[model samples]
Target: MDRKEQPLVSIVIPAYNNENTIIATLESIRNQSYKNIEIIIIDDNSKDKTLQLVTEQQKKDNRIKIYHNSTNLGMIGNWNKCIQMSNGEFVKLVCADDLLDKNEIEKETGVMILNPSVNLVESDTRLIDINGKKTGSFKRYHKSGLVKGKKIARTSIIWNNFFGAPVNNLIRKSVLDKTGYFDEQFTYILDFDMWMKIACTGDVYIIHELLNSFRIRNDSNTGNLIGKDRETYVAEHQRLVDKYAGELQLNRFEYAFSIWFRKFRNAAIGIYLRVFAK
Candidate 1:
C-alpha cells in the first residue's frame, strides 16, 4: 500500500555531520516493506553536507519531511522535538547513521498492537562496521531465544546495561508519554536510563528478530568516551544501586560488587589495555 493509504509511522532521524552514512540510513528506512512512514530528518546544525543531502532526498520523496534547528540542541533536544512533531500513533527513533532491518517496524508493531499490555518491543540486533559490513557476532545483552514476547522488567534493563548497551529496540509512543523522554543530562547513557524508567511503567516485550543494524563507528561518542564513559557509567550505576539499596535485594550484591568486583573489572580493563595497547 502507498504511504497515504496506510497508517503512518513517524521516524525521527537526528543528523549531525553524518554525510558518509546518512544516505544509506535513509534508504534502509525508505526501503522497508512497511510503506506507510513519515521520516522526519531533523538537522542538528550539521556543518558537513548532511543538511544538503537531506534536502536533496526531501525533493525526491514527499514522505520525507525535513526540519532544522536554529542551533544544535544535540540529540536529546532534537529527539524531543521529533516526538513533539510526530503525528503517528507509534514512534520509532532511527539515528541518521543507523539502519533498520526491512521488517523491523512491521514485525515489532504487530507485537505491541496485539499485546495490549506491552508498551515496548525490543528485538535482537547485529553490529556493523563503519562501511556497513557485518561485525563478528550477537549482542551480549539481548539474550538468545525464540522469545516472541517477553517483557523487560526494571531488573532486566539494569542488569543488561550494567553488562552492555540496548541499541535495537522499538518503543511505543504510550511508553514515552508515561515515562517521559530521554534525560538530556545523560549525554551517554540516556537510552539506558530511559529504558529503566520505561520498564518501571510495565514490562518491555522482546520480539526475537534481527530488528536493526547498530553501527559501530570508531569516531562516535561511545567510542570516543569509552575510557571516561566506562568509569562514569559504573560510578553512576553504583550510585543508583546505593540509592535503591533498601528496596532491591539484588542491590545488596550490587553494592558489594560496587566496592569489589566493579573495581576489579575496571582494573582488569586497565591491565588489558596496557598489555594490548588499546
Candidate 2:
C-alpha cells in the first residue's frame, strides 16, 4: 500500500523511570513492519535517563517524538497526555518496558482495515523477565474473531481477567473519544477499565497470534502497585462492577458471585507469589 493510503497509527509510550529498558522498547517500535506510524513518548519527570535515551532515538528516527511533563502526572495522567498528543486514527499504548514483534503493527492494523466496525483489537502476548527472556507463556481468552461488546464485558467480569494489559491491544481513537480518558481514581486496573469502556461502545476483535512481550520486573508497576495493594485492587474491581453493572446487565446473584470469586482468585495468587514465586 502507498504511504498516503495507509492509516497513521499512533504508538504511545508513557515512560516514568524506565531508563534500563527504554532502548529495547524504542527498538521494537523502530522494527515494526507497518511503516506509517508516529511513536509518541511522554516522559513523566523521570529521574533516570529515560528521556535522554528516547531523545537519542528521536534524533535517529523522524517518526519518534518525545515530550516531558514538568510535574509527575502519574500513570493514568501520562496516558491521557499521550492521547491528547496523538493525531492518528488508531492508538496503541505500549509500555516503556515492553516489546512489540516486528509484524505486530502489520497484522493488528490489518484487522482494523478489514473490519471497520471493530473499535478494539488485541493479540496474544507472552511474559518476559527483566533480561528479556521469555519467563512464562499462556493463551488469552478469546480466539481469532470478532466478539460482541457486551460479551467481552461479561466474560471479563465473570472470569475477572480483564483480558490483558493495553500493550496487547490496539484501540480506535474514535472509540476512545466516545469513552473519554482513563480514570485516575483507579490506581490499578486503569487499563482494564479503559478496555471495558471501549468494548461497551463497539465490537472487540482478537488476533490469536503472540505479537507482544510484557516485561515482568519485581519493581514493575503491576508488581509494585497492584501486588502491594490487594485491598485497593479489590475496591477498584468493585467500583468497575458498580459503574458497568447496568451495561453488563448483571443480576445481583451474578455480581455477588463474581466479587467473591475474584476475591478468592486474588487470594490464591497472593499465596502462590508468597510460596512459589522467586
Q: What is the C-alpha lDDT of each candidate?
A: 0.66, 0.85
User: Residue by residue across 1-278, what tens digits does model 1's lDDT show?
Assistant: 45565567778888899999899999988888887788988898999999999899888888898898879998779877877788776778878778887888788766766776666567767667776777633443354422322133334323444223333665667668776887666766666666666655654566555668777654676554443456775665565555444534455555565445545555554443333332
Error of 1 at 199 (Å): 1.6
Model number with the top TM-score: 2
Pairs with backbone N, CA or C atoms under 3 Å apart (clashes), candidate 2: none
On residues 72-181, what C-alpha lDDT tens digit does candidate 2 reach at each position?
A: 99888999999999989999999999999999998989999999899988888887877787866545565568988778788888776646888888988988767898
Q: What value of lDDT does candidate 1 attain over all alpha carbons?
A: 0.66
lDDT: worst 10-residue window of model 1: 145-154
